[model samples]
Target chain A: MSEFWSDYTVRVVVFGSALIGAVSGALGCYAYLRRQSLIGDVVAHSSLLGIVSAFWGAFLLTGSGNKSLWVIIPGAIVAGLAALLLTRAVTGLTRIKEDAGLGVMLAIFFGTGMMLLRWLQRAQPPIPGRSSLDGYLFGMSAAMTSQDLWMIGLIGAAAVITMLLFWSRLKILTFDPEYAAGLGLPVRRLELLLLCLMVIGIVVGLQIAGVVLMISLLVAPAAAARQWTHHLGKMVGLASTIGAICAAGGALLSAVFSHLPTGPVIVALVTLAFVASVLCSPSRGLLFRRRFVVD
Target chain B: MDIAIETQQLTVAYGAQPALWNVNVEIPSLGITGIIGPNGAGKSTLLKAILGNVPRLSGHVTLHRTDEAGSAAIGYVPQRSAVDWDFPTTVFDLVMMGTYGRLRWFQRPGKREREQTRQALQQVHMEEFADRQIGELSGGQQQRVFLARAFVQRASIYLMDEPFAGVDAKTENMLIEILHQLRDEGNTIVLVHHDLTTVKDYFDHVVLLNRKLVACGTTPQTFTAENIELAYGVAGKQLLSRIS
Candidate 1:
């Protein structure tokens, strides 16, 4: 057990997962409240394209496959933001609703990302970091370094600070956007910022839970937290804590076990938490709700 | 003869269809004005257009507020259906949103704001339900909570969309009494009102719409059966005849 503390990779992976989990879980409440939970999933899936693009861009720029955190983080952010922008533009300008638009964009971006990753794998010259590309799909927490931890910490801090600064306006905007506008608040800008924050949340955790399962870390904790609290502040706080615990617990389990995958482990723990919250919550739980129906 | 708000050649459309077409009217200062129209007659559209919630295809809504120097402080009570009632928030927190507009972009609601929110809840008789989650409230209580949200804001003009819909008689009377009190407190209140029988009792001025201005004047003078018929088509005759 002492060896677990000494292994640098394990420490990095566990801490990184906890940081990413807390940030995404906190920010995920906005998407959940706005009834746009799918957008977070879409943004996370769309980030795969950004991850591949960063590899390509880095390989072309320096004549070597620079699959570092610096190159990848910005690439993921741009792609996530692009996906959100395209969805917004399509929904705004055309008769296509947001659901249809997001689905189409998700397919296009994810398909392209999958193809690019294959191409990198089959490259004749053998891309230097091409072997590590698949780690982003299911998240290779074992491969995480102190540098990756630093990047996650920086982005997570940015997200938490921005959330604190715009807390009230965001609450109003999430609960009632029309009312926000009627009060002469800049509704469009605040909404755009909210989506941008979602992108930040997704981007920070892209490598920890990977593109495919990272969304669960955002969603499950929030859904669980909602069943337990009626206040927005408490919900967000509880969600963040739940996310951190699930992720850290998953990291510990994967570390102790020989063959377990980190991302799916974290996601599974969060899902279990969600189910427990649904069944056992004191006030809004399924069990409690049925009992109070006669009154 | 003071006009608090005036719309000139206002036109709005959703997709190919026009919701409001070439609407022109003046809302008088410091009185309760009822914007009366049949279902889909653009009554709600007019308020949204005036508040700039939706895009105006073309036209101008000019606000004439002598009290405030900058943009007029406008409080809005959108239809109950406008917001998600099951949202995770308490009555107090929702009402606290009303004071958010008065602060700077990044400023949080302080102690004074909380005091004002409590007062607003007290005024609406929702002070006791401050901690209750919004979804737990009845329809009438929800309406009252919405009213409290709007009332927390100190604005010169209040635009309410169907504050009387789906509410019981006791709640309706309380809302009317509150509206009259707000008008008496020197604020211009405009409502997109239904219920033809109560038009005379509730509103002092009336603006009837049928995708265009049918007639707008004093309730006693212009809220006649003919104007009601002009906007509501054949259904007006049966409804108004019963009331008269």
Candidate 2:
């Protein structure tokens, strides 16, 4: 217990997770408003392919198999954006709807990523950071370094700043896209900006929560916050706060219990918050609405 | 009479099917103009084409007031069902959005804008609901809120799509009064209206449409049984009989 409190690695991991949680949660509000929650899941899953591709590329370029965050983050962003574009193209060009397009993209990209990871394992000599590659699936926060924390902080700051700067435009775009376009706003460009932010948020979460559980970090906090407030500004603020708390708490609980994995623990905490919000939030909550019966 | 809007062979399509075909019409300035048609008659499509909301297959719409800033000359009230009512926003905040077009990028609504929003809400009799969440309002109140938003824009030309649909009698009367006030103040108001009975009473000028222009003239001159029949097919004769 004393060692856990003093360990710098634990401190870095917790901070990194908190930053990842806050950024994803805040950006997730727009996705939720746009009814594109599944897009977050799609982006997270597709980023796995990006990670493996980055590793392979690094191996090919340097003749050394080092999993650098520099290469991995950019690769994840590219893959996430590509997946989004593919989904858009499928929906726009074909008769398929957006949900079906998202489903197709999610399955194909994740399946391809898994195949690439397995092939990399069998095809190459034991890479230096190859063992930790599995960590990107389920996450290994215990192994996060100060460098990971810096990367998370940089990406998180960028996302938050961009959201603040374009707050009104994004709000209008999310709530009434057609009206925004009619008002002479560059609706397509604003949408692209939001998608880029979502991709960046997902990329930042990859090392902390991993592909499988990252969507929960992106969506759950916003969902929970939405129950408590009807104002978008308040919703974004509350979601960021909730996300930071949940991530830090989960990291601490996982630290206390060595058997519990950090990623799943964080996801469980977020789920609990969402459930509580659904059951107990005022005005809109199931229990409150039933008790009050006010329309 | 000055022409506020002129469409020159305006054609719009949804995929291969044309929504509006070769719509050539002139909307007079400084009065209430009704775009009356049946369902799927391109009434709404005409307004959208004028506003550049839909892609034009051919031709163009020219606004007479070329000196006005981009989109600032027009205020649009979309259909009630166009936006999600359950969106998380207050009445005041939504109304402030009307001022966005006049503002520079990254500039938020300020004191003057707030005052205008307040005045617009007052005009719609929605001042009391300023703080209320949009979803909490009744359907009539929601419609009034959208009107307030459009009013705050203060555009010279107003285009409304089914603004009276689903509203209470009181809201309808209030909206009609406001429209009369705007018209008297020399603003051009065009509405996509379905009720043929109110066309004569509500508007001075009318455009009868059925995917193409059936008639465009003063209401008394254009709102005739023959043109109504042309726009609404055989059923319009019966409707006209009922109206007369």
Candidate 3:
């Protein structure tokens, strides 16, 4: 255990997971409050297509396909935003509800992503990044390098700072969008900003939590924090802390165990935290054994 | 009287069906104006369209605010059901949002903002509930909270959608009093109102609508049985006997 702790690779993996968790957790609060919790799932799943499209674009442009995190992050963002905006547009312009539209986009995007992934794997010359491509699906945190850590740190910090700068508008927009617009805040642009931020947060974390398990890390911490506080400020602060703890702890466990997967471990810890919060939270818990039922 | 708002060929549609069409009316400044109509008469849709809450298929709404900075202070109180009540925010924080219009980019609520929020809450008699979560308030209290938010805006023009719905008589009277106070201060107040019995008493000017403008003038002149019948069609026949 001490030997692994001393290993630079393990440290990077753990720190990277923590950064992803905190950003996803804080941003997830607005989605949770707005009842758009499933958006993260949609974005994460749709980003698979983005990752493949990006790799193909690189392969087509240059002889070598660059599977670099920077290239794929933008690609994932584009795909994720497209999916969300398309869903909103369909919901607004037609009779299709947002949930149905999201579901449809998820299937089409992910289906195309899988098909592209298969084509990449079967390429005669063999794509250089093809072997490690599966890492984006279920994550390969064990392959973390110092470079990955830097990307996560810089991207995560920018997302957090953006949220802070737009704090009041975002809060009003989340709670009452119509009133916010009447207050003269640009509602559509603000909504787009939030969508872009959500996409960025999800895309950045793909390498740490993977597409399949990313939504859990995004939602669980915020959901759990909600049960403990009635204030948005406290809820956000607590959610970030909870997310960081569960992520770091899960990453450490994955590092110690030779065969355990990093994404699933981190996901399970956050889920457990949510369950505990629901059952035992003193203010708004499921428990009926309150020391005093003031009501 | 000066005109605070005028609609020229204002039309709005939801998909293929038009919610409102060819709505042309002038809302008088410095008084209470009632947008009286039945269900699906585009009463709420009219307010929403004017505020750009709903997309307009065509036409325009001209606001003849005495001042542009004052125009930016257009305060709106949406219906109780418009927003999620269970959002994690206290009454103080929610009411403080009214000052957001005046805040510059990257600025936050400061001591001045806090004091304004407190004063607004006091005006609406919601100061006691400042610390409570929004969802914890009663329906009427929630309405007052929304009103406090608008009051904090200190605007020259106020647009409210059904402020009296689902509230007790006491709350209704209090809300009426606030409207009277705002009106006396030379602020133009427009409300999407349904109750015919209170229409004449509550508003100085009224716009009777049914997808189109049935009547638009002073309440005593335009809010008549004949116009009500035209706006509501056959259903309005039943109301004519009750209101008259």
Candidate 4:
């Protein structure tokens, strides 16, 4: 146990996961308020396509099979942004609602990604490090290197700093976009900036929780924090704290158990927090409301 | 009379269907103007069009500003149903949003803005509820909160959508008093009002609309039975009789 605590890899995994959690949780407050909670999932899932595409493209161009994080991160960003724009276009140009558009994109992008991954596996000249692509799906905290941690920290800090700097405009944008427009705010530009931040948050989170479980990291902490606070700033702060704690705890537990995957464990912890918050929060909780009958 | 807002052959549409068509009207400055129309008569659409909330299919709207260096020339109170009141924010924070227009990007509200917000809340009799969550307010209180938000903008022109839709008598009276006070201070107040009963009592000028401008004149001249009938059909006469 002491050796586990002293191990450098375990320390990096824990710190990296916690940083990803805090960033995603804070940004998730806006997603939750905008009722676009599924957007994170959409971006995360679509990033898989970016990962596989970057791997294939890099190999084809350089005649090398080495899967570089540098190549994959940009690819994921491009794919995530593409998915976001396509979803917006589908919703804006057609009668299809935003939710339905997101669902369609999620399925198409994820399906194409899965097929590409399968083809890569079956290719005659097998990619040497093709298995690393799977890490972007379910995450491998145990395999995280110093380079991956630095990338995660850099992206996470950028997302959190941008959010803090534009806090007021973003708050109004999330609350009432029409009113924001009336005030002569650059509503479209502000919205695009927010989606760009979400893309950053989701991309960074993809390394720790992976695509399938990343949405939980984005949503659960914010959902739990919301039940406890009636102020947006406080809610966001609380969500970050909750996210960091859950991520660190999950990382430690997974490190100790050896058999438990860190991503699912972190997701489960956040879900538990959400349930506890919903049931026990002072003003809005089910138990409190049931007992006190706040009108 | 000085015209505060002028729309020239303004047309707005929702997809293929036109909401406001070839509407030309000038709102007089320093008066309470009531925009009265039947359901689906584009009353709210006219206000939205003027505020640039909705896309104008063609034509233009011009706000004649007496002062060039004000925070914002226009303040808007959207329909109560248009907002999610359950959003996590205090009444104070919501009102402070009015000051955001004047603030530069990334600039937080400071002492002056906070003071203005407090005064605005006091003006609307919502000072006590400033710290309360928006969702905790009654329907009338929520409307008052929105009004305070608009009030804090200190804009020369105020556009409100259905300020008296579902409020209690007390809140209605409070809102009417504030509107009168604002008008007396030489601010133009345009309200998309549904109640014909309060037109004579509430507005100095009335813009009667039915997809287009039916009448735009003083309440006595524009709120006539003939124009009301044109705007609201035969039921307009019945409503006028009941109100008169």
Candidate 5:
């Protein structure tokens, strides 16, 4: 408890978490628009397998417990992309509902990951110098170093630039893909680019926010922001701001008070923001619920 | 004198089910063309195929130039139910989206685009409701907003699907008036119409269809009882009997 309050680590944790949130928030807008909100949930859960696989792969190849962030980053991203492609293929080939497709993909991947993780745990003795990777499961911003913060910040900035470049086409495709294609927009290419972006955001955020809570970061803020505005640009901006605020606030609070899992704390903060939006947002919000009801 | 849209043996299918059969049709460059048919008779499918929103099984759609002046642009307005109305956007914002194709990628909507959106809204008489959330609009208003969107496209050819469904008589008349104005301006307009009574009154050309093209020409020539019966099926026959 004393160690938590006495450090400058709080600043790193909060700043890093906020950046993670902003990235997810921006990407989540597209996910929600494509009517693929639940797909985010599936992707988030599936990344645990990616992380575990990356961990074991690193362990086997390097025999180095110090952990190579470079190796894990690419490994995790590739694995996550594979899972996404598999999900899309299953949905296209079978009569399975999307929800069922997501469920099946999540279960199979996560199960294999758990098996690999257990095998790794039993086969290799604990490295005396290296800390356990369990911190990633729930996220501990206190354990994150400057390198982790740099990774999050760099990825977040890249995502923002991509969004700015293709905002118009992305908005059109998200709103009405059929209409967009009719207008001769590159609908297929744009969608594929968007999917690639989502995978990148999820893979990066999984490090600091953890997969379990990353979906909330991606979806909750955007959904909440939706209640506040009618413009897509404004919604994306507001959602990113709300997500960043929640992430920063959650990380700050958790740092100030020890024994808090940064992931769930950030999610709770985001949930609070969602409730506030529902209660207070101006046009068409849930709080204005009384106005729309007519006899 | 020119053909606006000329399809040579146009055919469209959905999976294994055929929605539209090989159909050759030539359309005039101006005036309202009422496309009437029974359910699953490829009324909407024909428009989708023309718009390239749906895949064409086989055919070529050639947009001819009027005396080498250059071909006209094609615009489409899908059914109101085809999209989620609750999507986060203002009526003005949605209408402005019609100009995306004309604007460059990085550039935002400028004053010119905004003015076009406003004028389009005014055309539909929805100028007062420009700032309204799309979900807040009634079915009729929503349909008008979409019409306004297509109007902003400002293309020479317009293809609309079920613009009259769920609309009030006033809204319907408003739409008809706009269509008339566009026709008078020499823009070709094709409407997927449900009502048979208004074909002769509302449009100059008519396409009667049931899975395949039954008849296509001027209202007097193609809207005959025999063609209407074939287009509408038994229900159309019963209705024709009642009308007579």
Candidate 6:
């Protein structure tokens, strides 16, 4: 226990995980508001293809796999946006519903990622010292360094700023898109901007929450927070706090154990919070409903 | 004396079916213009077409000056069922959203915006329910909250669709009073209305539509039994006679 406090790597892991959780929480509120909560999973899963493509592309072009974070981040964001546009186009052009569009996008993207993974395995190995991309597939909290912590913190701040800057427009657009447009709001522009931000957050979160469970961090905290409040600002704040606790607790537990996967543990903690919130929240919660007058 | 909305051979359709065709009409400012017709008579379609919510197949809609000063500001209050009411938002927050058009990016709502929201809530007699969740309110209260949101837009021209539909008697009366107030303040208010019983008593200007303009003028002039017959078919005459 004493050595755990002294270990610099443990500190970085804990801090990075917590910051990533907070960012996901903030972005999740908008996702839930848009009623596309599960789309976060779609965005996260689609990034795996981005990762492998960037790795292989960098190796083929420059004979290196240890590509800069800048290269990988932009590649992931472009792929994510392409997937979003493709899903939307399919839904609008066809009779398929939004949920079905999301499902198709998720499956097709994940399958493509698997194909890319197999191709990466077959290809000749590039320059050494570049780690396998598994850290993003399933987060490696123990391997987090000071640099990763700083990066996560910067991304978290940007996410928070995005939420605050467009809070009013987002609220109007989500609640009533037609009326918002009637009032001269650039509804389409605002919606596109928000979707862009969502992609950025999902791509960055891959480092700490991993591709598979990153979306759980985005949705579970916001869904849990929804059980407690109807006010948007309060819901966003509550979600961020809940997510931070889950991430921190998961990181601490993983620090104690030698080989436990931090991603699943963090997701499990978030799921537990959601269950508790569902049972204890004021209006919709099972227990609290007994106190309110039934209409 | 001033025209607020004018259409030139306006045609609207949804997929293969036509909702409104060659509907030419001129709406006056500074009064409540009631648009009443039978089901599928393109009442709501007319409103949507004018606001550009629905795509127009042909013709043009020219929106003139809202008031004597000629400001082009417009406001809209859609039907309650058009949106997901369970959205995570409070009455105050939703009303404050009306100020988003005026504020610059990255700036939060200041004290003036909050005060305007409060005043709008008071206008609709919803000040007491400002902090409540929108979903927790009754049907009438929810309508009033939406009205409050529209009021906060503070535009000189307002377009509303079925604001009194499914509301209680008190809510209906309250809406009439607010519309009259807005009209007296020199704002043009157009409503997609039903219930012919109160048309003459509540509204001054009227537009009788049946996929085409049947009549347009004061309620006594355009809402006659013949125009009602033309717009609503023979069965509508009996329905209007009972109420009239």
Chain B TM-score, structure 2: 0.97
Which residue pairs collide, candidate 1?
none
Share of native interface contacts present in candidate 4: 0.55
Per-residue error for A276 in candidate 2, Å, reads 0.3
Off by over 4 Å in 6: A125-131, A291-295, B9-22, B66-71, B210-215, B233-238
Global Cα RMSD, each model: 1.7, 2.2, 2.0, 2.0, 3.1, 2.9
Tens-digit lDDT track of model 3 for B86-195: 78899999999999988998999999999999999999998888999887888899999999999888778889999999898999999999989988988989999979
Two-chain DockQ for each candidate model: 0.63, 0.52, 0.57, 0.59, 0.50, 0.58
lDDT of 2 by residue, A44-115 (tens): 999999999999899888888766577789889988889989998888777788888999999999999999
Give the per-residue lDDT of model 4 (tens digit) for B1-244: 9999999999998867899989999999979999989999899999888878788989999988643455344788989998888899999999999888888877999999999999999988889998998888888988888888888877888999999988989889989999999989889899999888888899999999998889998998888888999999988778877886
**For chain B alone, what TM-score does every candidate structure achieve against the true structure?**
0.97, 0.97, 0.97, 0.96, 0.94, 0.95
Q: What TM-score, to 2 decimal places, does chain A of model 6 have?
A: 0.90
**For this target, which candidate reaches the highest TM-score against the unseen true structure?**
1
Interface RMSD, all models, one decimal each?
2.2, 2.4, 2.4, 2.2, 3.0, 2.3
Q: Which model is ahead, 1 or 5, in terms of TM-score? A: 1
Question: Tens digit of lDDT per residue, candidate 2, span B53-86?
Answer: 7889899999885325745447788898988877
Candidates sorted on lDDT, descending: 1, 3, 4, 2, 6, 5
Residue-by-residue lDDT tens digits, candidate 1, B1-244: 8999999999999877899999999999968999998889899999998888878889999989733536565788989898887788998999999988888867998999999999999999989999988888877888888888888888788899998999999999999999899999988999998888999988889999989899998999898888888888999999898898
Q: After superposition, how far is residue A122 of candidate 2 from its true place, in Å?
A: 1.2
Instruction: Write candidate 1's Cα lDDT for A44-149 as tens digits.
Output: 8888899999989899989998767888999999888888899989988999988999999999888899999999899898989899899899876777778878
Greater DockQ among 3 and 4 belongs to: 4
Which residue runs does candidate 1 get wrong by more than 4 Å? A291-295, B66-69
**Candidate 1 displacement at residue B49 in angstroms:** 1.2
Candidate 6's residue-wise lDDT over A84-166, tens digit each? 78998997777788889988888888779868877666656534434556767776677666765666677668867877878
C-alpha lDDT of residue B179 in model 1:
89
Model 6 C-alpha lDDT per residue in residues B1-244, reported as the tens digit of each score: 8898999999998756899989999999768999988889999889888777777889999898653334455688889899887888888988887777677777778999999999999999889888887787888888888888888878887889999988999999998899888889888899999888888888889999999889999887898888888988889769877986
